[model samples]
Target: MTTADTPPRTLPSTSDNQLLADAGEGTRVEFRGLVKDYGTTRVLHGLDLDIAPGEFVSLLGPSGCGKTTALRVLAGLEAATEGSVRLGDVDVSRVPTNRRDIGMVFQSYSLFPHLRVLDNVSFGLRRRGMRKKDAARRATDALDLVGLDHLAERFPHQLSGGQQQRVALARALVTEPRVLLLDEPLSALDAKVRVQLRDEIRRIQLRLGITTVFVTHDQEEALAVSDRIAVMERGRIEQVGTPEDLYLRPASATVAAFVGVSSVVPGLAAGDRVEVWGRSLPLHTPGLNGDVEVFLRPENVLLVAPDGPSGIDATVQESTFMGNFRRTLVRTADGALVRVQHAASDHLEYAEGVRIELAVVPVAARARTATA
Candidate 1:
């Protein structure tokens, strides 16, 4: 509910700024051999990463990929069974959660119902022995960072779900944490609000230049806000890179399959090229191969006239109308299903049972070495 029409608010008070400076302008994070075991089940396998100061890194993967466990270890909430967590070069593997200078916000808005928004934010400062008046002023300024200063006097019950989460953010930041940990903080909000709040969180993090570690299973969300993304799987990091790196130049078959809509087309491997759909496109396979599989994105498949060009013959099965692009499903002559995407304004007029030829873009594509 925070609107742009609201008056522009200045930064927090000098006292809070001093506290942040003392904590440093974001701290570097190093996870050396980070491992976690719940009894006999090892969730993390020697995870290693070096997060630069003030960088926004997202731990992204499927549900049980140990991203959450890694975040917990960094926050000192959970100890690593084997490995060390280094924050700004100090080994804090054995440090307790309370003694660590990190702020965390979870999926649930853990707001105090008994206190007002300002008081909730200032609670940590007040507990640390700041005067009543100073804590209130600092809390107000923190709320202003998240655009919740107008609601400082309101209670948790009076705020919307998004507002309540903003209050939680203000509370975490009011103490000037060395690092901010977010565990799927926007998961509970509606789709629209989730997008809005995630954008705001990214804006605030960049504005403060604070080190942040975000854990999320949502791929789009990770791609949207992260400076880099660590794609994890089976207790280890598969690859770590920017969003474009992960999508365009996947390191392995697993990465190519997991990151986006990678559709495999039946093909024949001939040296460094693969003959897929009547086209000898550029392809690279590490080892010797005869029959192979080529992966192409939906948008990579082009639609041409069924008569003139000798492209792959397919029968249109389904067509979907997205806002900017149209998604159509087709089955090749050999009964292989392929999905194609084109601009919404100029897509193939292929309806159900309409025959068409799909031209595979002859760029660098990936192929499997062996036959299935």
Candidate 2:
């Protein structure tokens, strides 16, 4: 449902200030066999998720994936076609958006254009029959938490986009939601502002000990902010783990391809061992045989002088100097382009056509070749 259309949700007797300050132990969230369909098009195919109290989770995926739809379901903005959503022990699957006791921040920073920042933040409280004076006071406290108290008197039009988003965040937190849902909340901000605001959001979430579900298509953003990420593909969660789990040990080829800079090289797999680039290596992915492709991140490939017993012969094709790191493109004798990442100051002379040796770290993911 649209922000303007959200049903009246106000706790008349409870002071927003007291509620916020004493926000009870963050509530756990559970999604059991959740499913959503648009006519014949199924968007979520029996999804299951469990979020611990005060845990930070990010639903990460590409566009058209079900991450945002899952968040909307949690917020009670969209009814699940099947399954159940429980907040703590209470099933909120059929709960109205206003009664779900959750707060959401959108990419657009939906602050009312007509109201000052303080009033926009206190709007929810005042609707609950809170005294105007009490709402304003609580709003100021919320603003202060977001580091926007000084901008309380300014209308949304008078503030910067980042400031407006901060106001929206304050508004969300002022209610002390049991669960915070962020739907691409930083997508509209500039790179710098997005980074700054995400950092701020993480800091505040940690300090408040609130359970949060952040939805984003940006892998880097998810990695930076989330304690764990659920990577969605098509209508299902491909994998769910800590940022490092999904990055270093992706459970599927789809996740390996999506999470980071991965280089897929043709190889032969036999049980626990795989041979790639004329060298034998360990395969971490199970149930792979015959011809396969081994995937490894650039950091896992080590470059050295070809004179040693450990290095595979390769020629430098290109090199790009990124701050703090250097990315070099090297082609193997088999015409495979392998990238080597190292310290920018390492000074591995990588001129075009320069012969070099690559020692690949043993751990890699193996995807079975499809027989057509």
Best of the candidates, lDDT: 2
Please give, for residues 1-372, the per-residue lDDT of candidate 1 as tens digits: 544344443555445554334444688999999989999999999999999999999999899999999999999888899999998979999989878899999999999999999999999999999999999978887787777888888889999998999999989988888899999999998877788788888877877778999999998899999999999999899999999988887776667767777777788877777788777877745553688777888988987778854677889999999999898888888877888988889745869999988888877777775444
Superposed by TM-score, candidate 2 places the C-alpha of residue 358 at a distance from the truth, in angstroms, of 2.3
- Checking candidate 2 for backbone clashes, the offending pairs are none
lDDT of candidates 1 onward, in order: 0.85, 0.86
Once superposed on the true structure, which residue ranges of model 1 sit more than 4 Å away at CA? 2-24, 368-372
Off by over 4 Å in 2: 1-20, 306-310, 313-317, 352-355, 370-372
| TM-score of every model versus the real structure | 0.90, 0.90
lDDT of 1: 0.85
Report the number of clashing residue pairs per model: 0, 0
Report the lDDT tens digits of candidate 2 across residue range 340-368.
Answer: 79889875688899999988776655555
